[model samples]
Target: MQTQGHDLVSTLDERTSNIRATIENVLVLPLSRHPSPRSVLIIGCGIVGAATAFFLARRGVDVTIIEREGPASAATGAADGAVSVASKRPGPMMVAALSGVALYRELLGDGTLTDLFKPRSTFVVAASDAECAVLEAHAGALRGEGVAVEMLAHETLIARFPALSSNVRMGAEVKGDGHAIGYRIVNRLLSLSGVTVLRGVEAYHLVEAADGRIVAVATSRGELSADAVVIAAGNGAPTLLNCDGVMKPRKGQLLVTERAPALNASMPGSIMSGRYLLSKGSQKGAEVSARGYGLVVDPLVTGQFLIGGTREDSDARQTNDLEAVRHILTDAVAMVPGLADIRLLRAFAGVRTAVIDGLPLVGRLPGRNNLFVAAGFEGDGICLGPVMGQAIAAMACGETPSLDLSSFDPARFTSLEVAA
Candidate 1:
């Protein structure tokens, strides 16, 4: 297993050599016009923070990341890595999700993520009449956005994916969706950017100057000053920004299964349950409860299966309850009966930070020019992390972001009044 992992790493290194050289050349070159924030401090080491540091460093800005835990020790380390837009509605989030997917593809082409990203379609399946109806409308929305989608009838679905159970009434093959492991992507970005990461440091408060600009961060270790500050610390942001009411924790449980090469190979892509749309409140009339179970069975490159989980309005991250695990597996096995034979390997949970309004906070704070917030992505962090990081980095440098972030501006939460 170690030898195989080493060989895979070597192959990826070879694949990324050309692009790595180009990026390194750009990094070594001095910038003609110095950006205002010559030095920036980021308050997280998750994927979003790592990506933000990478983009900032790439633009010749000195970047330092401080985290309460090690890299990917929080939600980023626990994500399912679904780079998908199939679950989003036709709104700002959907648009951002599309851009996020494009960015992943762009990174892959440039060898920045050649091996880390796996491009494949997401199959959203329906097992009931009500589910099929919701799925049809969802497919229409995806098509309207020019997303490649194939609405499969029951017979066609059975023909295409024989591993799926007979209970699957229909399925929609949403192309351009992909899967990636969260921790791997975070590590790669950090390695490529080569920025300083201060682990085991807790960021407590933001030190502001009389001019209403964030000048430093008060940490557990000591006060660290910087030209600019970014609060992307997930659950930690609400306290630092004094907007506790704006962010809440949503827990999710995920499971992994032992290797099943033949069963894994049978599926072309990850399987998303139609009920997941309802659970995520993607359907207009769908009501989301305090606890909802959404099924997603993803086949990994190592011939293992990744299944998940329950979305609960709780902050319990260290433990997974039997009820949630049982419900998730029941749904997963119902969709793909072949999973019944596979032994369960592991079950873990993570608490994702979600905003009250659903949309993420990804732009400059209301009146703080050098202060930025990029948290509250909920479950979409894995998909939006890198792209939003690049955008936030641009915003910090007083440049145009790759994606329009007006919809996600931090000013939306009026209660978040930063102390000057």
Candidate 2:
């Protein structure tokens, strides 16, 4: 790794140059002419921020993270931990999801994420005729995208997984999906990185140099100086970036059941309803409503079942309404009759930041050379957080990211008036 004050004026690699050239809509601003950063300040301690700090620390850079609360106290601690590509549409997000999952595999192999990631298949089932049609088309799309898929008829589905209810007409097994608890990953990354975290501190604004570089941050405690800054605070990012109105908070409710080893072992992997395709707008011609209900019954390694949830536009993280809970449980029981016998252990809700355009805001913030942003991933954050962090850390060090990040560039939003 290069030292501080090192000049970074190397030509782009052939692959990177081709990707940059293909990106037509983004502003394509040049990296700062200043030397590479010696110190980096991360504005969130969630999974994304933690992962960023981890990569930066690995590169021998001084990294410090500031969080409004304890690590993973917000969305990261409350997520379902599904590192899945089965629910993604075939677009930039899908491409990113594939890369994200691949990174998870790499981290697992390198022991950075040992026992933190659990690889498995996701079985999606359809109970009604309409859902069956959607399931078939979705399965075809997944195969077209080179995703390993197997269509299961009613008999084969029930025989292979007797835990499912008789209502399931058909199913599709999506391979290469996995699950990991969000808070666990955050803690592991922070521990491995050995970076200091300022809990209970909040950043209010960015301080800029005369040459339009972000040199410091104004926070509740005081002003902290750094060579570079990254805003990964989800919804909290819009205000600090001074780029409001681009992202909004979306809420989801989930439930956990008591140990049911017999039922859990009967299934080979997590079960997703065909409706999830429509809810996520993965099915062609499907519209994503403000409030959508999708079912996913995940069997945890602890012999418990994790069931979820409703996607509501409002940001009500502290409360789970009775209507949503009842509907989710009803759907779960309908899909798996044995679930009706298990006792409910807990019900919780989380608020995730979602951009209006669906894609997350990553890479350098437009017009702010030393500033970067990686937030608004919505539900995909758990899957994409680490990879996006790796990309941001590379950018902060004046290197081209391995993945094509032009699609997620913050410069795509013209109305974003970011003031230093």
Candidate 3:
């Protein structure tokens, strides 16, 4: 990290030595520039901000990212990394997910993320008729989008995974889905994509020019100049942007079991309960219904089954409650009988950003020309981040985005009071 100023590292340890070499695989750059920047400043280092920075850099944009912590330190760190499109609801959300699938394909094709982009099938199993209906409809929706889906009957599903409880009525398999380690991809994007980063600084205030356009941001590290800013800071976005209730935090708990003994064969991808279908997006008068039943029995690459999760409409103070863990595991054991014998290692939690309307707020902020908002992705951030990043970048460059973002306008719910 070659910085012209000593103040940049005044409070740092030796980790700032190479910036990029701090981690074996991470790449980092310091805040250094010639004249004032006409560049864009992204206020998060999660998947969305990272992808936005990557695309912006490709467009010759001088990018400076101000991350309160390190990259992938929050929501991105806690992601299951499932690139499953079937999990997306119908309409614009699914359309963006299709774009995400295409982006993953392009990224995989160019060897950008092939190694970490694990191509695996996603198995969604239903234990009851109601769930079977949901699974059947979900498969039809996926097939409607031209996604390859294979529906399985109860008997056929048993033949595939005998360890699965007989209660599982049916299942659907989507072969094209892939999973990636969230933090790994964050580091890979930083290493391969060009962006200057200032870690441990919270972007506090937005400085405006005489004509009222955003010119810079005041961070904990001091004022960093900018021409445009993207608020992809996830759960922290509301406070930073003063969007108030626009972006609320949704809490979830997950458990990682000890390495499994030799499994029957490798379980095909992840085994999602029909309950998982209920949690895809918000339901009318049913926002709270998706709280504790999205159980997934995911066998990780490390032979450890990654069991999860409980979606609580709570604040950042929520932890991995024991009862929630018990409930999640109960659902897991019901779906996969063998999981009852699996030793539990640890239980953890993460907060996802949810909007009032259940859709992400993309494009420029309501009242500001240069302030773009890409928060409120909730649990779908891992799937929609790449496409949203590209679309937001196109909007920033004054070009028409290929994705129709009219429905996702950040100002849809309320008219922001900043500028018009």
Instruction: Give the per-residue Cα lDDT of candidate 1 at 146.
Output: 87
Q: Give the per-residue lDDT digits (tens) of candidate 2, residues 309-343.
A: 87888555657988888999999999999999999
Query: Residue 268, candidate 1: how far off, in angstroms?
Result: 0.6
Ranked candidates (TM-score, high to low): 1, 2, 3
lDDT of 3 by residue, 165-252 (tens): 8988889887787777788888877766546678888888777666667766776865666567788899877776666767678887
Candidate 2 wrong stretches, greater than 4 Å: 1-35
Worst 10 residues of 2 by lDDT: 3-12
Residue pairs in candidate 3 whose N, alpha carbon or C atoms collide under 3 angstroms: none
Clash totals in order: 0, 0, 0
Question: Could you tell me which residue pairs clash in candidate 1?
Answer: none
lDDT of 1 by residue, 307-369 (tens): 987788855565798888899889898999989998999999988888888889998898887
Winner on TM-score between 1 and 3 is: 1
